[model samples]
Target chain A: MSWQLGIEHLRDLARGAAILGTGGGGDPLIGRLLVEQAIREHGPVTVVDPDELADDAFVIPTAQMGAPTVIVEKIPRGSEPVGALRALEKHLGRHADATMPIECGGINSMIPLLVAARTGLPVVDADGMGRAFPELQMETFSVYGVPGSPMAIAGEHDETVVIDTGTDNKQMEWLARGITIRLGGVAHIAEYSMTGAEVKRTAVPRTLSLGLSIGRAVREARAVHADPVEAIRDALAPTLYSHLRVLFRGKVVDVERRTLEGFARGRARFTSYDGTSELELRFQNENLVAEVDGEVVCTVPDLICVLEGDTAEPITTEGLRYGQRVTVVGISTPALMRTPEALAVFGPSCFGLDVEFNPVEDRAETPAGVATSLAP
Target chain B: MSWQLGIEHLRDLARGAAILGTGGGGDPLIGRLLVEQAIREHGPVTVVDPDELADDAFVIPTAQMGAPTVIVEKIPRGSEPVGALRALEKHLGRHADATMPIECGGINSMIPLLVAARTGLPVVDADGMGRAFPELQMETFSVYGVPGSPMAIAGEHDETVVIDTGTDNKQMEWLARGITIRLGGVAHIAEYSMTGAEVKRTAVPRTLSLGLSIGRAVREARAVHADPVEAIRDALAPTLYSHLRVLFRGKVVDVERRTLEGFARGRARFTSYDGTSELELRFQNENLVAEVDGEVVCTVPDLICVLEGDTAEPITTEGLRYGQRVTVVGISTPALMRTPEALAVFGPSCFGLDVEFNPVEDRAETPAGVATSLAP
Candidate 1:
């Protein structure tokens, strides 16, 4: 089903997308404001179902690429994403029938909305990554046979670079990452241009609506004095991310973070309230692994999200700070994302983690593996 | 005002270009071999004068951009320059009427020949830099108001990146440099696409012919047992570059070179045979400053070329080594390149040198300033 996403829907969408961002995907509040401003100026955008599009319809996925920490300070010039889209359209000599999110997480989920709002093009309700990954090759679109090249990246001053050839998606990411650093550590990109059929086959479907539902559930639960953490679990119960669990309830004790090679890379350690247990989360932009006392509890392609202890609000990697009371959650990724092919692209080993791919459900089933209590 | 460049002309062109390279521009022998291979397969390329072009003729300048040190080891695939040219043509949606050299030095001079030999496009007998400068922005084309982008860069594996927008030439260079490093240390580029009128007004005219004359002079002088260094001076007597002098004749004692940020950078120290003085040549790809006994004798936007003491063969920075018998030559740049606007772009300070850009003639006028003798 298609829906009209007006200014009113932005807050919930941002909240839900932040949760899905895991820890990366840039700052949600900044993205929300940018989207709100764009929509306010250009009017509401239509969120279309991927299935409703013709096979010949051209769809372009657009997002931001850089260290989330840099994006926090280097606010996008708002026109960068639209400029990138237009540049790509000009390069391909085709008008995009719809714009979609490359990744349905944090600011990336909102970038397409901003582009759609500004260009008056409907946004397809799907994304390459249902949850964020650090590099471009990690996308399901690439894993499922979409070329990342013929991609356009735009900087704040309207500088546009179109990468027309890459041996593979990894090379494309390498080239784009280098350019992004030169473009002031952040750039808006329009890439993975696909036909409607490819979008229907490769994209994670209905992610925008899913983000909105997750956001609304948390908001409603809060108003009704219900446990927002349980509300989040209920929201994912009927979705592809059906296995959700609270990995830990603790205060952030240490964060060793540094912006490196176009990514925010670091490890954050949390101490449980009883002070006897510890959880360590290592991230490269987004949370990639969660370890309880050095025992792996969850690793990507499973979501390892850090949320506020009481409010259940998503906390991005850049937003993590010492002494903050937090709740860590682990949710299983979609079946398509956990496939052997997909895992090869974004599995724990891809992030240089020593562990193998193990689903969150399997890890959570072990009684001693997780601290599910929500108490701070 | 046009001539055919067959396999016979390549030797002279490469020799002259290496002199003009001012100790940078990659390895001439490697470039010559690549061009020779291409020409043998595709036949000769026509060299057209700037004046011969129709006002609306589409011209693109093609060259290799990276450290000379890297280009020597990496070696081009011979197809990269043409790939870059074709990609840029596609981006612009216009067929190029001709190709030209972005610089009249080293491997860059041969790159356009290779592209033309392959594409059957005539090469304009002109270039952006009469002599080479390390960065893209340090070009007469840019100094005289040509845009550096809508530029295309192609790697060995056929990966192409088109930079369609850069606020200015420096930003274009900065962006291209970052991409070049990611492209495995060397990349071929087609940039500064312009109209024939822009070419006529901005380019350093007939640099290819000038390079040929310099090479022929050195070769003939050597064949006849004449002073090859003096022959080099005579070759530039009537050209736009009228001032020439031997800055030093000595054996290289210490050479410190490292490839950094896509440019070969270091200093070579030369000791006079009498052991009374020392000459230090500091360079970033291309020689930027020549200091004799810690006193500046030459600096950009003039040329500081290093040549074999006996053979007068131009030696690139990457080829510099301790114990090599060498002679440093300083030549005045053309009047157009000495303009305030041009100096601001490539002057001494631009390379972080402390001295002002004094013409080589002024510096050589002081008898104690340079050693003009041919003795080792």
Candidate 2:
């Protein structure tokens, strides 16, 4: 099945992407506006489900690479993503039949649509990650054995860099990040070039509609004066996401932010108005660990989202401010992400946390050794 | 007229290139050995004079990019320069008939020969920079109105980044340098792809032979126990280089080295045996300025070379060490580099120094001022 994404779907998609961004992916405010403008100018973009893709279809994933803080200052030129896609197609000596998002996260989730709008190419409704990750190799495509190149990265100045890093996706990221920093802190990339068969095999299907529906549910709940968090839970019940829980509701009392290694990193602390409970969230671009009174409540491979308490607006890691009332939610990731292979790269141990892997839902109830869904 | 670069010529070229490297360009030791090996395996490369080229011949310049300090640690894969040239040729949609050095500094002077050795292509006996400058925009091709792309940069892992920065050569250099750092601190690049006509118009002719002759002179002088510095002077007298002077001879007493912004930078101080006079050499990869007893004696756009006092071996800026006995020499640059456009980008004021630039030859005879021959 396929659908047309008009301005009507932009807000919900952006909203859900922000939630899936896990407090990183950068703020989607500008990206949402840009996609909206592109769609309005170029007409609605067709988004086909991965299953609907022709086996021979050439599908290229596109995203922006850089620090969220730098993106805030540079504000994407809007033409770079499209330019990168075109350049990649030229290098491959073939036209892309469809486009895909490298991941479902903040601004990146919408970048493919911008490219599709300009190129008149349909965007597939699946993504490499069901949610966002900080590095290139963390993508499902790479994790499942697809190469990251031949990839093309383009700058707004008509400058383009087409790279073929062979099988080393880590080196690809290193080179891409280095080039991004020099291109005034941001560059748009079209990588993970694959056939439709390969994409259907490795991609997390239906993430586009999932993000859109999640956003719509939250927005609809707020209209009727209902709890938007509950709306998100209800909306996710039918999806691959298994468990959802509200971990904390408090006012942000402190935020220690620092730009390190080209990423915005630090911790945000929140305390209940009654002063009896406290929660601390530590992050590197994305929220990686969350704890309540020194008890590990949530860790990575699972989602940790911080939202503005009153309106249910998700706050990005870079946008977290001191003294803002917020709610933190924990959601279970897809089963594919909990596999030993995936856990080795993105699990709690990978982040150097002292605790073992415990599902967010069980962590609060058991608080002790519980056999993890992923027992690596 | 065209000649061949044998092992004999390699020694002279390396020596002359070190002198032209102006205390930077990393040490040519490893580069010379690599070239010698390549020549032994593939036979001597044909060196074509720019004026003898066909009007439509494709001339691509090749060089290594990154910190010279890093080059010492991460000796090149030896195939990267050839790979870059091949990739650039593919991108250009035309075969390159010949290779050329981007500059006559450090290892770059020999990289083109390495490419020619493998591809069976001839190397032009000219270069973009009569001497080396740290940035890409400071090249004769750029100064003379040639663009920096479509250029290709290849890494040791077979990772290649082909970029087209249009007329913004500075942006090209920024992107290339950034890529080089990620490529294990070093990469090889082929840029300024041009026609033989452009090479004849813009390239500094005979630099390859100039470096070769300089090296031969120094080696011959040392063989007979004659003054090597005087030999260098005699060798350069027949070329565009106007004046050659032995600026100082002393024992290095103080040396400070620090890696800053990917370049080894600092100052080396030497004092005469009697300690009556002192020489200070300040460098950024390559030596940029030399002062004698608080008086500015040499600056860039002119060559400032340092050699081991006894063996007449050229010492790169990164190789400077305390307690080493050395002699410093200054040589006038080609008139082409003295143009206002070139000086505006490579002169003393461009380096943030307060003093105005004076022709090195005139600086010694007339401390106040003397009219420069190629004044803009």
Candidate 3:
């Protein structure tokens, strides 16, 4: 169904998003409140189908990249994306005809509305990538040959700088991140310029609707007190599912970070409520892999999500810390991310994992390394 | 300075490049032979000034970025930069009019000639970065707003991928480096598409000649039996000779490398000829500083060049190793690199110095870590 931002719809959208966010998207309640409040204050967002787009329409997609943990405490100034959009418009010498999500999970899902509301641009019901990625260039647009540079990327206080990685994503990342670090850790980026022609060719068609639908299913489950996770799994129809491994649900035991080329990279360890088991999540941007008992289980391209222990609610990486109860969950990559190019973008190796590619099935067969479960 | 080259010019260019390669450009011997043979078999390269560029003059820049050690063992299978050029030109719908260096240091300076001569494009008198940076986007062009996307990068066997990193050098770096690792740790890239206007704004002017002159100075010093270290010093005209520290010639005792985000970041310890003292070189890509007896002398933005031991020749970071004799030299950043913008680009903090900027003068009086050296 199209967006109607009624309390019921917002409820459903949040629930469904929890399931579909697969482990990486932040808890949807906050975003739901935000989107709902924004809608309540501004009116419900109207989602336009890509097929409805005019041929000459300009479409822009935007998102936040960096450690998810950083996003929680720092909170976006909310002006960065808007500023980036305005800058892009200035550069293009025209207003964007439309805009869409670059990623449909976590804060990114809500960001489209915030930006759309500000730009007066229709929010397209689509996304560039079907799932989360560690870097800006991993989007499907790059796979389809879209440019990611000369992009209007803004930081806190509306500090905006356009980057032209000139086909070098590493350089582009360094340039944007260097500026962002100069501004602070988090940044709002508006990247991936496309003609309607190219957008049609590359975008994950109707992903915004998928986001909405995923949101809806989770709502229905919670309303009926059903399993929201199952509701999401059924909705996405993911090609495969590995046996789930619940890593831990106690408190964050440790967190350490190192700045390399100015990006936050490090690891976090959490202990179980039982105080007997421990879970470790290693990440650069999105959580890449999870290890229990010192054994690798979930890997990149696959999803490593965290939830509030009792409620089974989603937990953005940044929200994780000591005394925070979190249950870790893993989701296999949808068949879309399994594409060679997609894997090339998010594979285990992409995260510097030394292990060779082991598809979801093989991943499950491997024993979970939960600390208490170890042979000790 | 203009166009047209005879056999003599190719020999001069190659020989001059090797002399200046600072011992890290890979053995110029084979590459020089290949290029020399290419020029001899075909014709000499015509060097054209950027001003002479035709509006449609197809120009591409090429370079090697990785553990330089890998480049020697894995000689190109006769593709790479040429393959990148083919992929780029194929996408551009035009033949290249010229090819140029990514940077005029080490082997990278000569790598572009492989593509230039192979594609029949004149060698350009411009380079992307005035000096070598460890990562792809650390170019003079990147600082000036040139991007690294919409690129043609590939492996030796010509596994070409035409990519647009969308203006984030970080993305380009991630993608190119991902490809490089996928291709076994070496990828040749041809990037930076300018409308001549962009190039004029961003590309460092006269860096190639600067390199040639620096290389020439070293050659002249050796011929006259002058200290090559003094020759490079004479060539660069350091702001403070008082801070000059010709650290001891020595052999590496240990090396530590961490392949985080595809960069080899670590430090090296060396024992001088006296064997009682020690020198350590800290590196990200190029050497950023030199410490003798635990004192910091050179720092980033300033240059910490390592020339060969005895011979006092320049040695690239990757060229350094255990049991290899090397003389450490330091040079200050050009005034251009001293600007806040330039310092921001290559400052001590940029390379993880974690200190305030300090000029070479005070750096000598106290040394890099002495609190004597702070990033400005």
Candidate 4:
């Protein structure tokens, strides 16, 4: 059965998306507001599972491309996503049957729902990345042989660009990011076009529901005065993200960030309240590596999430600031992301890091009540 | 009636385009080779006057966007221009009846011919810019109220982007140049789409024929051992450009160039062979200002052409080198370009220059036997 996403579910979705964001995908506040506004105006958005999609269903994946800092300043015109999709449809000589998130984290997660609300097309429950990724070609769709273009991008200034980079998703991302910079640092893109069958085979299934559950768990825990951190662990325990643990609980002490080639690249350091060991996080739009006391603690595609110590609010990489007390959580990615084909794209080596990727579950000690597998 | 663009004519067109280039538009060598290959493979392209077009005929303008230095290094796949046009046409749901050059100068002139040769469409004898300018919004089409967007850009990597910037051409140029940089420093673009009636009403008519005539004059002058500088003046005097004069005859002494924001911006200084005076040329894609011996000579909206002293070969901005003997010629622009609306866009102030624009014919001393009138 299909489910409708209304205002009641927005908070949970935002929380869940942030958990999956893994410290990237940009902040979801504006995206959540945009989705709420769209849903209110156009009524509730319908979301369908991958199995429910017809064989010939035309699915389009979309997200905002640019630095998170820029996205916060450049609000979309609301019509750009629809305009871009229409332009792409005009180019393809057909209409899309559904929309889907390019990734499950941050703004990308909400953008597809907003697009669905506006276009009246049901959004698929699956996403390209089970978690947020910094680059376009890193998606499971590409690993499964889905071409990134012919893609469509629409700027806030009523400008739309349709890109065709063949199978080279890297080139497409380079070109798209370039346009995004010119569009005042942010632009909406619809790419990774596929049929329902392709989506079912390659996509990370039920990610939408997973994010919602994560968000709801935190919200319910907060209302009942339960531990939100433990709630997150319990929420993801039965899902693809079966392993979860807190890597550090400390105050941010240092951050070094610079916008390079339209990406926010930098590192953040945190120190324990007792002045013990320090944790350093490196990222390019998303946290790529986490080192505690100069030892590698976790690496991508394993999740590295930063949540507020008290409010349990997830903090995006772009939102990292000095002196904020936060808890860093690590979670195991879906089994699909561990395959050789997927690892080559999302592993630490792909990001130019030298360390061999150790699954977060294997690196972290299993808690008293939790059973786990350490096999790679 | 339509006419064929032969190899002989191609040489004249390139030469003429270089003259009109006003030290920008980029080097024409690669563009010439691309067009030659296209013509050789697809047979000669057809050239048609604006008056010959059907009112409803779809006319698309095309050009290569990027720095000349970049174009020299990154060659095209030869199919990108046609591919971009096809993409635009597919988006528009109609085939273009004709092709037009966005400018009459440098590589832009040859790109249309190449596109025409490949698409089997007639090349319009009109252009948006009588001479090249640094930005896309400076076109006569924009001044005359034609929008710049609903345009398509294609990369050599098989990527195409369609833009719609509404009444904002500056944004369009910014976005387009950004895409160009990401496409390995250069990309083919098809923009400023219009109908045949709109083309006739707003386009600088007969720019192709005008460029051809200027080129032929220089070629014939070189062959017959006549004064090439005088030949240029005589050639332009009969067309919409009535007043022409030699601004300086000198050897380049120094050049300062920097690639910034995807444009080759710099200044070139030349001292007369007899060491009597010096001429300074400042450019951004095209020469915008010229000064002789610390006095203003000619500025943008007027042509500041640099030619080989003996051969009358025009030199582009990027090709400027120390010690090259050259003759600088200034030609009055079309009457259409001098309008208040047009001047507001292409004037000196638009380029951040402090000087008020004075028509070249008004500023320059009228030679004996030459009748000139200058009024804005």
For each model in turn, which proportion of the native inter-chain contacts is also found? 0.98, 0.98, 0.00, 0.88
Worst 10 residues of 4 chain B by lDDT: B367-376
3 against 4, candidate with superior TM-score: 4
Looking at model 1, give its docking quality level.
high
lDDT of 3 at A177: 60
Using DockQ as the measure, which candidate wins?
A: 2
Comparison by TM-score, 2 against 3, better one: 2
Backbone-clash count (model 1): 0
User: How many backbone clashes does every candidate have?
Assistant: 0, 2, 66, 7
DockQ of all predictions against the true structure, Cα-based: 0.81, 0.82, 0.04, 0.65
- After superposition, candidate 4 runs with Cα above 4 Å error: A364-376, B364-376
Give the per-residue lDDT digits (tens) of candidate 1, residues B222-248. 999998888989999999999898788
- Which model scores highest in lDDT? 1
> If scored against the real structure, what TM-score would every candidate get?
0.98, 0.95, 0.57, 0.94
2 versus 4: better TM-score goes to: 2
Q: Candidate 2 overall Cα lDDT vs. reference? A: 0.84
Q: Write the per-residue lDDT of candidate 3 for residues A219-274, one digit (tens) a residue.
A: 56778887665565676664333334444445678877554543546788976655
lDDT of 2 by residue, A319-374 (tens): 88888878788999988888887787677776667767777877763221121111
